[model samples]
Target: MRSLIKIYRATADRVTGRNLDKAAARKQLRILEEIEFVCIGAVAFGLFLEMPSLCSAASLVAFGVLGEFVIHRFHVRASKREQNLSDKESNEQLAAIAEVNLKAETERLKRVEIEERRAPRRLSMEQFNIIESRLRAFAPVEIGVIPTAKGDAEPLEFAADLCVLFRKIGWLPAFATRIDHTIRLGLWVELSPNADRLAQRAAPELVVALRIAGIAVDQDVSRPAGGEFGGTGEEKERACGAGIILNVGLHPVTARGY
Candidate 1:
């Protein structure tokens, strides 16, 4: 009996391998054990009823096959149930993360409002009019300003000024501040993969414009993680969708430029 148990365990290990789903495999093994017992009982009962050896063997085989079919159906259903439960849990986690992000956004907005009230207006109406006049030749585009840290008002202020300038030139501009620790230096203008040709062409010009406005700006093109251009220690930023992602970094006095 011990030798048989050892053989069974060896066979199970060989069949399942190292990467097999243990829970599902164990459930299937249990079902197989139950089927083995049922087959044995059916064979014994058939023999006790004076059935021929051939008839008993056929009955055992039929019972085993039927048991396997039923157990297989149950196994499939069980796997699907587990998968659904996993998906539900994952979705709930995602929703929770989104809620947290929303709350953080709300807080950032409040800070921005406070900052706007406290920080004296830097650009006069006449200077803004001149920027608007210069931007008249270029078509309008939506711009997003993302700050790298909370309460870092320099980037937010720069974005705000750009927003005012762009709005004056009939462009849509929005800003969102986030607490990202990766960004260290000059402001980054990230363009989306499917960004319009006009936007792509205007991106460099916008960078130049920001520099001329005394704000240090650079184009940020992040490579895919684990790719040839990606560094081992670098955290890849998520891609912006169909527009521009402006990453606001720290002021020069706070951190050195990269």
Candidate 2:
């Protein structure tokens, strides 16, 4: 019953020159379709009256073919309208998705900028535990913590964190002392030429522990020039346990090809 009703309505629309699927087609295009229907009907009527001899047969056939042509044209134009509408909708959806992705990336960059403003140089308790276990045999070894002079506060804060990590593991790490040095970047563990076997073994372990804790420290190439850890005049820093000194230089570089 519903199909019959739809068929009846479609026929009625063609006879009355009504617009087809107004919501799916543009207003001007629908008006043009309606005008075509009216013109076809008028032309068919005029041909029927002018040819009285074959008006009932040949003229009727001509009108039927012209009616089919009009319906075919309407369907072709409606299909084009629907395809254009779908393409427009698809483009809008893609543009919206691109905007959302760009905004998320901008927010991520802002977060990175804020994180770079301050150094996240401290270790968590879990990191401390990992370092402590790695440096277990090196306990009771005294370590001298030294910060480079004319450096920013980040290195000092990093040195303080290092001292805390050592103290929690039963080691006597010295108070942080600042002095000028030729070294300008990164953390280092001192290993002078005169150091004994115990200091030699323990220094590398400390470096490994710090590296495991996500902190980069150098033990290799850390022996001072001329085998002496000296700097500006009258600067005498403490030394502990076979000359093991923790030198905190400038903050670890982020992008030196490291």
Candidate 3:
């Protein structure tokens, strides 16, 4: 039994980088152990009444406790190993995604490289003035900022609700999907005075929901200045673009913080 506990500790230490959240894990293990002891006691009480061998009943209880301890130790070790593997896989996936993103950026830069090279020296005065006029005519509009980690599910809910809101209210159909850990929502939503308000309110709700669901909410909120648009609309009424989210965890509710 001592050797088994040593093995369990070693396994956990190796897998969790020696930074295991001991408080949380120990709390959970203790709960399980308590439940096991209660069950074993009940069973022994019934057996002892039938057989009248107090010594044997006591030994049986000891065995039950030892068995439970072993199981508890193994369970903790297994969970840590699984978590370690999951973390490793997640890092690998992120690296692959970053590589792909870099390649795409390189391709885009190459396509615009020639145009950028020829841009400055050959431009006539009249052409430059026209470009400047166009730039000035483009109004800079502010969209609400979405803070990453404000809520656990903000990113997903905001994206889903945005897609729906954009399609129905703005009359622009948009697609929403998760790419890696990021949720990407792209489509044209008709610009209106209340668009910012709707986005701001919805974004925070999603973050809260994700936190409740036990999934870490951390991401950047980004919107491009210009995209494809179909028509204009009046700000007749305000609406919400809120998404749904929830929390999930293997740890007991009370032990989650640990």
lDDT of 1 by residue, 85-153 (tens): 444445555555666676788899999999876664354565566556655566566555555656655
Q: Please, what are the lDDT tens digits per residue for candidate 2 over residues 64-173?
A: 56765876587676656655555555555555565667678789999999886654455567777888998767676666676665245566666677689877877666
TM-score of each: 0.36, 0.59, 0.32
Q: TM-score order of candidates, best first? A: 2, 1, 3
Worst 10 residues of 2 by lDDT: 249-258
Clashing pairs in 2: none
Tens digits of per-residue lDDT for model 3, 97-169: 6666767888898979976644422223443344334322222222222212334353444444433332332
Q: After superposition, how far is residue 137 of candidate 3 from its true place, in Å?
A: 28
The lDDT leader among the candidates is 2
Cα lDDT, all candidates = 0.52, 0.55, 0.40
Q: By descending lDDT, how would the candidates be arranged? A: 2, 1, 3
State, as a TM-score between 0 and 1, how close model 3 is to the true structure.
0.32
Q: Is candidate 1 or candidate 3 better by lDDT?
A: 1
* Candidate 3 wrongly placed segments (more than 4 Å): 1-49, 118-258
